[model samples]
Target: MLLAAALLAAAALLARGLARIEGELARAAAAGNRPARVEFVVPEGSSARRGVPPRLAELGGGRALLGTPEGELVVLRRDPTSGELELERVYRLERDPERHLRREGAPLHGWFLTDVERERRTALREAWERYQSALAQALEDFGASLPTAEEAAAEVARRGGADRLLALTGPEASALQRRTAAIGLARAGYAGALPALLVLLRDHQRNAGFFARLCALTEELSGLALDPARPAEALAEAEAWLRAHPVRDPYARKGAASAGPVSPPR
Candidate 1:
């Protein structure tokens, strides 16, 4: 009777252990199936759905000041391993010179900056600076030098110069690289590169040439010279104008004539 009781108790303990193991396994499976919260950053002046910037991975730690199509400024932070970007904060960029200068100097990530948060923001700022430096180095290393006005024009005249620069506006290019490409495209007279430039400006407001080069390109591409002195107003006005006057294909209407039915031999 004692032996029989011992066997029954052992079986109960074993069943409990098995049940716990199964539960753990089920939880692990569920976690593995959950998708990573990765988001693609869209370019500034384009549709939110069009293109994903290549610089997304490099903009990790949510240090980037990203802009949505609606013109809202957002700070995004990402998990290093999971590559998931979570919204850390949002700020409405003020256009007024005094307000803009004041707000630009204030803490962007939070209402109040603790020592730890301050350190983090500083680190992020350093990272951005480093990335920008690296981008300039990369472009030079790639031999697409755009040092002066004359050099830029000559570079664009070279075979694949415009194409190579245009390619930099793709997902792989950094904000600085994209901005450089925008200038090159404008100099190349490639109007198609306008949207990419606009998107770059929208997505990265902190990037250099945000107002100067971008505004110039906008005017050249769209033929609507905006007031560059007021960057905020100019950006918004140019966006509105571009929306109203979309670049139609030079041959879209022409295709209709070719598609019509031909008469049979009579």
Candidate 2:
């Protein structure tokens, strides 16, 4: 009886929180939204460089993204006929940024960073810096022992060794090497790799790229991206997924065709 009462209280609180969110959304929908004017930052030595820039339609008609006052990314559509840019078709109440890109390999061109997203990215950058710093310290301690980032990535893609890839992600390897291995595991789409990826995800050294790549692999492999915000829940869900899809190949049937196309966390 006590447990049931607690669950009911929790449900009521959730409903109230949701109601407040819905009210805010309704109020915001009634107001005008503005786009931010800022330059895009292409990460130094980053793999995904095809981000759509704002006013790309000025060069030619292309689908891009726009940041609005509402702190969300809205798809900017260009009319192929008139070469005019506008918001995507019929996006009134429903405005989930991920919905903007329906195609599997579509490039998310323009960056629309909200204050919240900026804060999040700043934190992520710091985490990456810390991770890289730790990696450099480890590298100084152990000189040139394991394979290079390019070599490790290539090896994992060429030969289906999930264990080898997992090892490369450990503390002994450089950040570049570790990122490449994680990207390889995701792009290779190996069923055996999925379990290892989940373990790595749970290991959770604030691996920002891993989360996005996990979305890519989960979607590509099972046609699903069931994200649980919390890491523990996400691991549980992945375990459930493994149980559901038992008969998958150990490696990519068609090698790493895509150069590790990553998507936003869903």
Candidate 3:
């Protein structure tokens, strides 16, 4: 009788360990996908659902539920158009288990400065100053010989200068350089610079301040002699990119919120 009891206990423990391992595997697979949508729910005094999408559903082998270390629920899914897995929505599991079970990935939070708080502020400050200096130099070089507005605009179009400006800087310095270059190009009436400027605007990992700068540059550029219809389309593309790949600084949790479904490319 004692032997039987021990065996039973051992079996139960094995089963529990297997279950835990399975749950972790499921979460890992889901996190790997980083889907556009996810839903989650938190039960009272328990872990919240991390929200995995259905595309990752296969990994769970039809088991619809998983738990986080904190006991949060998770669901996963695949995008219909791209067939890419994403987390769609999330909710509190205790309040509505059924709904939470069905929830998908939510709009992920953007990266904030707080996420990188441990970094030396002085280092970051110095880096930023250096970036500004490089940007200033690029702008000056690009516009150096043009004596008149028309000549400057013509020069920007002929040089394919935005690419050159971007090449001159590192990723850390690219944002400032891009923005300044865009402004300079726009001021000179360089409609050709719009495509490259648009690319920078759509980048997800760029800091919020940089996005604001892009917006300002876009507005300034839009006022130029270029075709007015294109800027709207350009802005829309940038917004779409942001929604699909929401930027988050690993160190900072703050990032730009999605503006919602982008208008289909016209």
Candidate 4:
């Protein structure tokens, strides 16, 4: 009789556990299918309470019923007859934690969405247009040159064209254009253009040494004489510039080594 009683007790416990699991599943299904209102609490220093919706959607799947700039609330519904659960509408709640903290005189660190789609799109479009225009102009000038021009036309075409472009437009014209040409010449190992870039670097009126340094480093890596004159004055000036504003490019160290030790400006 004791053995039979023990077996019965074990079965009863098993049934209870199963029932509890079933109840939890039902609750989860209902929550997924039902509509809910949500409230979001944004952290301090956030530009906008915008990312919550997408993050919630990803976490909850398409079952998210409502989403607001502040937060999202979702409902889970279960079909009584079919024993199936579905997610209903989600409600978004908007609350700015930073604003609240500010009101309460609490310290808050600011947040900025650096990869915002709209801002990225605008930047890309502007860059594309500017570089395209510059490249078109350079090509046109190349076409205008005579078949048998002064100096090696092919070499000039290769090295002098970019320098000419930089001279005409000046380094301050467009950041995108300057960077694009700098990168292109750097990749091609064009050293002849370094002289023009150095001139820009020396020009106090144009604070474009950073761009020039990038170009110079590229040519330097190609085993070219960046400053052929090695004039004491120019060397001094280059050294002074380097001291004031160290070159950040990884390739610059190599350039510096190749150029020899430059004395600081007097």
**Top candidate when judged by TM-score against the true structure:** 1
Model 2: which ten-residue window has the lowest total lDDT?
A: 52-61
Q: List, residue by residue over 1-266, the lDDT tens digit for candidate 4.
A: 22235446666764653343345444444577343333333333333344652222222322323233444444434455775545544444444447545566543544322223444456545544544554455456752322112112222223324344334334565533343343333333343334334443444223334434433453453333344233344445554544554433322212121322111112
| TM-score preference between candidates 1 and 4, better one | 1
**Worst ten in a row by lDDT for model 3:** 257-266
lDDT at 220 for candidate 3? 46
The deviation in Å at residue 209 for candidate 4 is 5.1
Error of 2 at 21 (Å): 65
- Give per-residue CA lDDT, model 3, range 1-266, as digits (tens): 22235446666764654444445445655666432222333332221224431221234332333344433344444445664445433332333334434447522342122212223344445444443454455457663322232222223323433344334234555454444444445433343344555675566223444455555544443332222234455468555544543323111111111211111111
Candidate 4 stretches with Cα past 4 Å from truth are 1-32, 49-61, 65-130, 141-266
Listed in order, each prediction's TM-score against the native is: 0.34, 0.32, 0.22, 0.24
Q: Lowest-scoring 10 consecutive residues by lDDT in candidate 4?
A: 257-266
C-alpha lDDT score of every prediction, in listed order: 0.47, 0.47, 0.39, 0.38
In model 3, the runs with Cα more than 4 Å from the true position are 1-180, 204-206, 223-234, 237-266
Model 1 per-residue lDDT tens digits across residues 1-266:
22235446666764653343334333433555332233333323334545433221123222344444454555655445674445576655444434334565764444441333455556545544543454566456553333342224224423234445556767787655665555555554455465675685565444444455566656655657676566667778877875775644311110011111111111
The clash count of every prediction, one per candidate, is: 7, 3, 51, 25
Candidate 1 segments whose C-alpha is farther than 4 A from its true place: 1-154, 157-161, 203-210, 248-266
